[model samples]
Target: MQTADALQLLLTPDDDAEPVLIDGLSIGAAARADTTDRKKDVTLEHFWDETGDPDDLEEQRWGVIAPEGAAGDRLIALIQPLIDARREAQGGHEVMIDRVPSAMSPEEAARWRKQHFDVSVELARDLPRYQLILGDLNEVPLALQQHQATDGFVGRLCFREERAYEAYVDKVLRWERARAEAAGGARFFTVHDRTAATTIGYRSLVQPAVAQLGRYKLDVADLGDQDEPSPDAFLEAVKRREPTVLFSISHGAGAPRGGWKTEGDQRDRQGAMSFGRDKLSGGDLGDAPFLPGGIWFMLACYGAGTPDVSAYWHWLERLKQSGHFGGQTQSVLAGLPQGDQRPFIARLPQTVLANPNGPLAVMGHVDLAWTYSFQERDTGRAMSRPSKFVEVVRATLETSRVGSSFRELLKASIVTNVELTSLYDDAERLGATPDPARLGHLWMLRQDLSGYVLLGDPAVRLPAMRRRLKKDAASAGEPGVRVHEVRAQAPLPAVGPAVAAERQAEDAPKLPPDMDIDDVERAIGKLLSGSPIKAVASEHDIEPKQLSALKEIYRKAGRAALGVK
Candidate 1:
């Protein structure tokens, strides 16, 4: 059998550049799992149907979430103008902007999510369907945001200055009041053949998605290749600002071959995109007009931001322990940031978002992006899974709000998680070893889908072309002009208002406030060891039902779901 490096050499055209699949994980790691027919059949299209009527403004409630207490209060005050504008836009609909429990890390975020959103019995559903987070990864934490986004529309805005927020709100209001020029045009830019990630993304995902978009009659521009892969050309395209949607495929700047000169340098440049030899950073943008009144889907690693830690950290460590791709593992590990530094929203996105002339929202990967997101090979055959990517483009082109479009992309995580759970259950039931390869594939799928997030207000959408403009064009006998249509979404199953209250009265246990998972497990262990129920309940200050619930959680999803790992 060929070595992993040798296989990569066989597949990749450029010897100097590693294949994205290899960069993401070694061939040996990929070889661990194969021919999972279950995962192969799972497709994103099955969950593409949106719930609730698209035309109903009432169905689209909007809210802003931030950190709890002083920090959140200050941040909210800074962005109050934007919040007020959004609330006014909602008209009669109630818009509540609230703060989440204080959480500075993913684990803390998980705890807060469990206490609120993940409860088995939801007592109140007061918040809106669309939520815009109001801080960076440090303030609110990406884990909490990602969890909320699983079934709801979510976006984030992080700015260092109050003036930036003021500028952004003014920009949003201006754009909302008037239609953007050539709003129906969608542009695709790619540094083609540069790396495996870019090459496959353009050919497999971008091409197919564009072909699908042709049915909507949106003007499409496909540009970027070795000859035209300069930052100047890309900047010029953005300066034109004609397209309401811009899609690009390239490498997000990672740790250099020699490593970053300083931690500050890494924070600023880690997520920048390389155009030939030139790099595009927020500093490079410098308050310039970039995708004004538009949306951007940047397909690159850390294009959105870096998490406090990579979700794949543990999995990569496991692969490394398996004794293959020693050097390759370290190369990837260098990018899988641990506790060495603080997580941050990418500088490029932050700068553009705060600009007066900038995109309304950006959809991109928050962690190390890989070809695993769009291409699957675990079923023993290479298959393209571009529906998630296509769904975002399709929704945006159809005049859906950027938040709703982002939710469409995230729906794949639900599909992937369900399959992952099923795989876990089967292994447990049969008392058989779980297939490592199958687990790896499902894990990657879930992480890849979960990594995508929105950076901006969820309420923002591509502006509708003015009615007068449309009428004038019609009088000129403009043929084949595409009109935006509001397609019906299947309504979510109706829930009785009293049903949740009743369920909470019965099954909902009053868990001790902010109890960590390890503590819960210790209590469970004592109970299993034949300790008195009343004694355990009293000792933990939790209801007996709470203990039962915690045990079930442990049995099913393990302690990780509860809190600290």
Candidate 2:
């Protein structure tokens, strides 16, 4: 067969074909050992059951975690109207908003999170469940957002200027106040990259999610297949007022085969959605009415933005060492923020949010995204677990808050963390090494889960829900749809320090009480000079785990401070 024909056949659509489960052969002996769970309880419903209806703002307070100093003050002032609206919605209650002094970058955010929430994330009850971050990734940091998301319904509001922020707030308020009407169904737009990731997402997630949404009596405009995923079609779909939710899957643009030329060029083009030979850049949308007042769930690498350092950088490096997907790995490497190019939110999302007619929220990945997120190997068998992905679609179509819907995806990560913690505790107790296979699997899952974030207000829901509620209210002869009022619950008692300390010691040990950033740097230098983890820990009067954790924290902080990844 011709090479072109062979490639086409391999990429042929097979709705009934089972997904490829096993990822690849192990790279080393350490990776061959298995210590993780065979079947992770990665269902989205479990998280919803535990967290309750985060969509109901009447019962849950909305919070904003703003940046510190003058910039934060200016941002808060720009969105003061939004705070007032949410407060009125909550029956004149104060919103839980605060500024963090040390969370401007991922490294600083990590330290802040470690100091506040610790390893296991448990938010104080008095704090709001629905949290909004009010700055760009560069201004507020992805680390702080991820930590808050571990337990709360969190989203962000980051735009290029004060006018854009004001415009977004206006767009959201107008969307909510507009009269409700029956709307078009959800739109499922997907790209056929011919790679396994896109193929499996199409077969497993797109097709299935479309079908499932139909079952919910929601209208769905299925825009999968070859010809429909172009930039023009995407724009047309966005132009229509109905279908307030667009769920798309695509390969985020990385680099030209030769690699990027300059940092400016890379930042401008990276993370654009690949539509065959055609691509969709944020600039392509202009100031046009794109997804006006709608919400989008974009599944692609850096669909949100590039982080300072990809969590999967070392893992992918190991894969490359094993001689796996060398070209693809290089492409991803080239796409990452390299050499003094500070992490920033993607241009597409930034432009869209800035546009007066753009989406209310854009849910996407902050780093390299792999099939590892939705596809998992089960007992030596590869399986597609699209439940979590599909649930987000369902929740959005059902008019749930975008942040709450994204939490459906976060549940899978939470499950993996529990399994990982269990494995670690077992290994520590039995003096046995955890299975390398299990460890790698759970680690990837956890990282992938943490990468998906919301880029808008956490409290915004689809306009379709508003129409439905209004329609119901009219039929019942009521003044309007009455939102049931509920009192804010008192703060829950924190976990006792003894238990918290014991858990911290078992996993990532806390830094020595007196050690500061400079002390951490010196300790890291000692470890780099061939000192064993035990020796370094002994010298610092800390556990080996503590030393290792401190080294990572210090390294990330130092690199970021030096304007390098």
- Report lDDT per candidate: 0.66, 0.67
For model 2, residues 1-565, the per-residue Cα lDDT tens digits are 2211111111111111211111322323124322333333222212223544355454567878888899999999999999988876654568877777633444565456556433333444445778888887667777778867777788888776689899889988887766436554688887765555577677767776765555454577788557445677777778876537888887777666666787777677778777756767786768888887778888877788888887756655666666643334544556667766677788899889788778889998888776667666523444667889878877776566788888889888887778877887798899997777667666766777788999999888777632221123323434432456589999766545544444444665455554444435555776766555654453333567877877776565555445456
lDDT agreement of model 2 with the native? 0.67
RMSD of every prediction: 17.6, 20.0
Candidate 1 wrongly placed segments (more than 4 Å) = 1-28, 31-50, 54-57, 91-94, 101-111, 114-125, 336-340, 432-434, 465-565
Q: Candidate 2 — which pairs collide?
A: 21-382, 33-435, 33-436, 34-435, 35-435, 185-219
Q: Which ten residues in a row have the lowest lDDT in candidate 1?
A: 6-15
What's the CA error at residue 543 for candidate 1, in Å? 56
lDDT of 1 by residue, 244-269 (tens): 78898887777666666677777777
Each candidate structure's TM-score, on Cα atoms with residue i matched to residue i, is 0.73, 0.71
